[model samples]
Target: MILWSARWKSRIGASTIRGMTESSTQKDYLFKTIGVIGVGLLGGSIAAAARQRNLVETILGAGRNPSRMRAAQQSGLLDRGTTNIAETAAQSDLVIVCTPVNHIVQFIQTVAKNSRAGTIITDVGSTKQQICEQLKGTLPAEVTFVASHPLAGSEKSGYEFSDQNLFQDRPCVITPDESVPAEAVSRVRQFWEALGMHVLQTTPVKHDLILAETSHLPHVVASALAATLATENFRYTSTGFRDTTRIAGGDPTLWIEILLSNRDAIVTSLEKYTQSLQQFKEAILNNDEKQLRQLLEDGKKKHDTLNSAP
Candidate 1:
């Protein structure tokens, strides 16, 4: 399935024939060129990390925005950049779809036709179930498709904000269905680890449910809290209020897509959140000092535990 191969070697050094053969086979049969389908913060960071560590022989970026693609190329994040997804997929040994959640299925479909046989495909989406479902039917059987989500990001977007070390020691969750080859899954894990990330494996459904509470709920609550405070007492706000709501200022379009794509899990999370809020409200209304104090103390303890956690 591969077109060519390259063995890792220094100009002045030589390798055993067996070592060279294995390296060449790994480059050709395992991985070589890595394609990133959205060179914004997450994609750019991945590309930069791969290049920094020589994880792949080449990194190519593709996106609708030519300007961002050019920026990624000029910033040393990618070896090449283009607006054509097919070209990127066709040329890459590994393809990481890093576009917004809403665009992921469409992008995969767009590039699927041109993806080479045995090309390893992956994604960096917040939710994984819908993405896995779409890829299950549309992606070619020859292409090894695996879903992954790296648990690292900033409340920022755009290529300019990308950091090469964004995934360093971060938890990168991989969701592979039964149809995925064991070797392919291992290769995907090895690739993420090569980028200095710790790999965690989970089912797509589990990932969606856990993240709905641990990730999406926090973003929604932060935005809601900021909106309520700004409406009622913006004039009295200070650094503490600003810091707490900082993530609320994240890209609205991106968040909306993520929320809508994973609506079922998010709705479940919201129901639990609303029940907790109602309990607090009832405590205040009944003038139950003990209940109110317990609620506040519990919240403080939980926050402290999270802050102190590894």
Candidate 2:
């Protein structure tokens, strides 16, 4: 939701570079206040990390339930709490929409309407293309939207399970379109990096496709695997069975939004996966030991490469 300025092109070349390589410890107190729209795992953890790193003067929590906001404020996770989106955005220098993908667009529209000039807007949404598309030009000239997805979270949800260290050593992707100012993108990247994340940037389309393969597909597979098992077999399950399907335990409501949002990309990944499964099925039925061994080895090598990465 950014209106482009001619001057930002002068420094556009440096935006991605600074995002990837900047090591400035001078990032303290970059914002006077940051408002987190949801008080769930990612949102609460962001509040915790910003506090621990001394990155802001104040932290605010905005959500639906008044009782939860009171609890978060009482727990010291937020300096203030409010159910009013405008009230939070009006006071925040930076507003992060941490709601699920389905609600992010509407929340952002509210934020853009109420945010003061020069306020920076961002999100922890896992999917970005739709958000970017829906809110493309709907902003005040000074309010900026830099879509971000922190590639960090747990099957578990809620504030109590949120750890400040959750983003440590994790990857965060910021998707800023051509109309966004380079300076805005750099600021959002700095926000994530200050929290111990490795930052990257790309088109929202590419981000969705990549995450479809690495994250969404896996969750679907895990849930499907878990569903295939019988209730009577639960007592006989071992670590391998449990480990393979642990992501199935994630809240079904949240996962539903994620799955449908990126269903196109996820379907592509699933087609490739089903082909692999078919190959394995044929190999097993034909008793082709060599073919089965080669498929297993191929999977192992790919996994080994991932584990070997620094």
Instruction: Using TM-score, give the best candidate's number.
Output: 2
lDDT of candidate 2 over 1-310, digit per residue (tens): 0211222222233333544664633444678789999989999899888876767767899999999888777667777867988999999999999998899999999999999999999999889899899888777787999999999999888876667799998999999989889998998999999999999999999999999999999999999999999999899999999999989999899999999999999999999999999999999999999999999999999999999988
Candidate 1: deviation at residue 37, Å?
0.4
The C-alpha lDDT values of all candidates are 0.82, 0.87
Error of 1 at 162 (Å): 0.6
What does candidate 1's lDDT look like per residue over 15-51, in tens digits?
2342366564565434778899988889978876776
TM-score quality measure for candidate 2: 0.90
Model 1 stretches with alpha carbons more than 4 Å out = 1-30
Worst 10 residues of 1 by lDDT: 1-10
